[model samples]
Target: MAEPAPHGTPRRYRHGPCHCDLCRAAHAAAARQRRRDKAYGRYRPDVDAEPVRRHVRKLREAGLPLPQIAALADLNRSTVSTLLHGRPPQGVPPTRKMRAVNADKLLAIRAEQWIGAAS
Candidate 1:
């Protein structure tokens, strides 16, 4: 169990308009912890994702939205958005590199789609 707030601190300054030093320090520390947690789970995509990037670029050029691209790529909309916007992939642990298998699979799907489009 934890000790209750002193009945005046207002619980880390998040509740209302308190500007006390304690609240400010607590808020800053909480912000830092949030940032660290976000970074810790960030997944760095392959810098050399040219093949998939190019494919995604073309699909975007064709005016296909993220959900459509994701459906065609057989991936999640978030994954397609990360590839489309060139953001680092998220939701995977930083210690594990983004899976090459997924990228390769996208490339293969892109090729298949292109071939199908031609015919």
Candidate 2:
């Protein structure tokens, strides 16, 4: 037999200020919209994957522990362990090197322009 909810048992509040019936419905709808947006990459940050992988490799080469590497890289410790052990980190997509050659070229151009202006 199912036990009835205790008297005056408070209902769990959703994640918003207003808790009226309409407000609750609106909040639920908004939460679903946010989830959809995240799924479609509308609300996600662009994470560069290669840099994270490189950093993980470097940390492993430097003899850093998994916990230490995770703390320094802002990654989960389990992710660090997986990377070190030659396994893929869960839910982390590989990132491309966005500014690899372009960054160097831009820096060189800026340095030349700075020298010309200074001279």
Candidate 3:
């Protein structure tokens, strides 16, 4: 069985099934932080995948394999693959967005650095 969540926290109010004043305050505080971050442009959680997808394609065309691109981007091989070719059958569709951090990682890779290394 799972352990009980501690008090005086938003998690307690959410997962701990707590509705005490402390828990409510904690949840409200967390919400405020989120709002502030969004307002200040510091809460970029995701970004458009089109640019990253194009970069991945360019890297592949420049001789970097999927695994190499994944490693250079510090991402999973499947993630890189999914960026290029999404899940099929039911037509789940390619990724429309990706985590901002991940997009940064992928965007940092340059095809020039791996053009000859792929050999």
- After TM-score superposition, what is the CA distance of residue 15 in candidate 1 from its true location, in Å? 28
Instruction: Pick out the ten consecutive residues of candidate 2 with the lowest summed lDDT.
Output: 2-11
Clashing pairs in 2: 49-95
Best by TM-score: 3
Alpha carbon lDDT of each predicted model: 0.57, 0.45, 0.82
- Model 2 per-residue lDDT at 48: 45
**Candidate 1 lDDT score relative to the true structure:** 0.57
The deviation in Å at residue 88 for candidate 2 is 7.8
Which scores better on TM-score, 1 or 2? 1
Residue 68 of model 1, lDDT score: 64
> For residues 14-74, could you state the per-residue lDDT of candidate 3 as single tens digits?
9678999999999999889889989998887779999999988888888788898899888
Model 2: per-residue lDDT, tens digit, 1-119?
Answer: 21222222222233223466666666677668668988987754334445555655654555555565455445455444543443333343333442233222222232233335447
lDDT of 3: 0.82
Q: List residue ranges in candidate 3 displaced over 4 A.
A: 1-41, 116-119
